[model samples]
Target: MTDLKPRKMDFGFDDADVPFLWNPENPAWSSMSNAVSFLAVGFEKMIVKLIRQAKPLMTDPAVAEEAVAFMRQEGHHSTAHRQHVAALIRRYPGLQNTLDAVIGEYDLLTEATSINYRLAYTADLEATFTPVFKLMLDNEETLFRPGDDRVASLFLWHFVEEVEHRSSALILYKAVVGSELYRMRMAPSVFAHVLKVIRIACAGFNQHVPLGERKVDALSMFARHRAKQRVLTFFAPYLSKGPMPRAFDGLPIGEQLTALKGAALSQTPGHDPAHENLPVLADEWFRRYDAGDDCTRWYTAEPAASGANR
Candidate 1:
């Protein structure tokens, strides 16, 4: 069984200062990416709650155990993003108000919704995010190669773990309430909600960017257009053809981590999450991280320079 237990990965965000556009070279991409992190701060708590609600319904011990691990990881993810959101609001003048409004709406949804709806939404969103992360990881060089080390490391760590446990929610959801009709029905709304939040957050991020960088931002936006396309491609099969029987039959955690680098690239039919591969640097980052090297340097292109400055 996959050891779904979450690792105590304290990336030390409390002390680090980060730039508003951490990926300074590509403000557009930075805005979209940061917006996702921003959303996670609030929504991941909902993920944990939904997973917890579903875990009790899981009869399979393996699925139940993985749910426990998923809950821990999601809790850690939410805490990290909450820390980043605080720092982000400090950096950008109006972001807090925007975030507060979003959180307020989210709180209302959580209060009014059933556990089934929440679980289905969480599962769909997890599936959605996994592919987007894959695209970012695959194109890490041109996209994120030049960025603030602390900020980049924060995101890299998050995405690495995201790929690691991408299937947890879906597996539990299926085991609890395996309804193809319900899954298909909820997917569109889930993706729509996710896109709405991203759009709002990205708009705020762009508004804060300097006018001089708008042209560069526009070009970067065009370059990342493929990411949006990949999102559709990733979910299209499930939406149209129905969710795969083994879609959530994910590999063990050990195999999943080992397969991530390649999985990001191909994601062969039978083996997902495990079948995909990450970008060269990202793969190496995980290698160092797994090996217990000072992999925090994975955040920056120049480890020595980053260390000296720190």
Candidate 2:
């Protein structure tokens, strides 16, 4: 095995200046999806802070630093997505009610637990998000990785950042509880809430959109943009991989179990940005949902498949 090297952590970046958004012509329903993602992330940042303090007591200083870096990247994401959602809200005035619905779920999630529970939440979240994180990069590889320009740069910007600080919460969880059980136990909890929010936002998709003279059809909207291809391409790598990544890796189980299948997946076999719940602000659609989740228990122990497929 290659020796694990401590990675440098930094939140400082030019992406701070990147325009708050893209895909401006995207439908209002898309904005709602963005809002949900942003909301999930914003809430998760709180949990990030919790894990940092716990990390040092359990692991080495290097791990603590990584936790902070992970938190910072998530923080940056939160700010960017917040701005993205605000811009969309401005453009589509009538989308307020559905926007509130997404936020409402976020509120409920926030109020659901204590700091410890929240830490448990991130531990759970890591189980949920880690795989998706990998899949996102895998999907982007065709478009972004292995290139020389800034565009390619941004792909790893998110990905390298993901790799560099991936273990923050997991290390802490081992120190605190020292359990292999954290990974499995937390997955369902995280999925339940996340799925609920997604279901509401997806269903409310049409309500947020503005149709001039014609209403948007969900099926047609999904078909228009190579959405199916994007999904299948990214997920194919996951399905084809010979064995599951061990839970010890701090990879989210969500990455393992889903291509976003039941986390409220919708097929717009014929959709496009203008008529679908496609993310208007992809950044926002991804970040704002984790409200103080805790992943401290995620990386502590190996799974039963000893050294199988890591």
Candidate 3:
């Protein structure tokens, strides 16, 4: 049994992650959904980076098999997410510049080729995403809300996948670069972004969108799905992921990843949506995402015909 466990499952985004497509019903959601395309461009880059790193580490035949599975799942995740972002782009034409700018920033950062910089970038991203997952775990029931299902699926699936492979890159980072400061730097940034995205999305927006506007009460919606709870929920188990000062045993990154992946596979559900979908989304993902059998092409997104549809 692998020592690694699947982190708590959760939805990462709040009402802000969901867009209303210009429906006067909830403007913040629309803004959030649209603005998130910029967020996802960075997320996609991170996905690609992990893929590149995983390639060489996957030398052992069995470990290599797991690495391939991880790739496929991530590829599907990126594809599904990009498609969802495409939906948002169709609705908010103005988001193009935002998406491009974020991508450009990634290009600029990666051009330098500093592993520290890349690790920092990865840390920042993990920090950014932590809250979204935290939220999903905190409010497992709220995620089933009728209107938010699609957006919840988007955020939650990503959230779960993050936890499923939570230890992989961190282990890899430590293996390649030998930096504990990286972990310290990453922990704080993770807390920061998770808090900010929620505060702005839920609290700030709720003040603007009144209660009488929708079928369901908007305030309750905000309260139930806020990011604070989500973030906390995710970090709970890791409170003991290691002793207060983690034991530095010099474990091989590949072996640790394989163990974690194997454990995750035991816990998670089937990968293909066509098959019986798994109940635990992220664990399943981290386990089988890289399976060579499932990897597919990620296409450049094109705008939908109507701004209202996305």
TM-score of each: 0.73, 0.50, 0.48
Residue-level lDDT of model 3, residues 91-196, one tens digit each, is 4444444455555555655665465546544544443233344433333433322335555455555556655554444334444454556545544544454334
lDDT (tens digit, per residue) of candidate 2 on 1-310: 2122323222223333321122122222223334444454445555555655565564566655655565766665555445444544555555455557766765665566544555556655543233345444444423333222232333334443434334555554554664455545655676677656655544444355433311322122223223544455477853221111111123255543553542222111211112222212233312311221111111222333322221
True-structure RMSD for candidate 3: 15.0
Clash totals in order: 10, 44, 25
Sorting all predicted structures by lDDT, with the top scorer first, yields 1, 3, 2
Output the number of the TM-score-best candidate: 1
> Where is model 2 more than 4 Å wrong at Cα?
1-36, 48-60, 94-104, 128-130, 141-160, 211-310
Model 1, clash count? 10
Cα error, candidate 1, residue 71 (Å): 1.3
Best by lDDT: 1
lDDT value for candidate 2?
Answer: 0.41
Write the number of the candidate with greater TM-score, choosing between 2 and 3.
2
